[model samples]
Target: MSRTTFTLDDLKRILLEGSGVPEGADLRADILDTDFTDIGYDSLALLETASRVEREYGIELDETVLGDATTPRAFVDAVGAHLSAQPV
Candidate 1:
């Protein structure tokens, strides 16, 4: 099997797809200053999103790290880092 270079947009697309969110919805718009609560992204929603992201990105997100990402930017940064560190 081959691996793909995951990009920020790719991550966003995957999240949207997995979560059944609408197209064009900004995934990184309120990052850094807002929490998932602000965007209606609850724990269940997050779980679904994370599971989807895990499958799409082929990575296992660290719960400890996910806790630190309370905003969109953090999520993006975390996902980027995870993607880089993922085994090829």
Candidate 2:
């Protein structure tokens, strides 16, 4: 399988949908308003979201990038970087 390019909006949509947030939710606001330690996402939820992203973009995310993702913005940014670095 080959990776498809994704824009920031595309990545946000994937993340929002995977995270069970409404399509119209303000991603920036959502991230900014959350407390990472108490964000309520279980390990399974994070794994699910990460797997969804990997499936959607056809890329296996690096563990280093995954480890740094402590917030929604971090997730978005890391996924965006992966998308950008993927083969054309």
Best by TM-score: 1
Q: Give me the displacement of residue 52 in model 2, in angstroms.
A: 0.6
Off by over 4 Å in 1: 1-12, 18-32
Look at candidate 2 and tell me the lDDT of residue 86. Answer: 74
> For model 2, how does the per-residue alpha-carbon lDDT over 1-88 read when each residue is reduced to its tens digit?
4555544466456655766654444555545435344555545656777887788678888877556777666776787788788767
TM-score of 1: 0.66
Query: Candidate 2: global Cα-lDDT?
Result: 0.64
lDDT score, residue 13, model 1? 68
Across residues 1-88, which tens digit of lDDT does each residue of candidate 1 receive? 2234545566456556756554544556743456766755666666776677777667788886567877656777777788787666
Q: Estimate each model's TM-score.
A: 0.66, 0.63
lDDT, candidate 2, residue 45? 59
The local distance difference test score of model 1 is 0.65
- The lDDT for every candidate, in the order shown, is 0.65, 0.64
RMSD of 1: 3.7
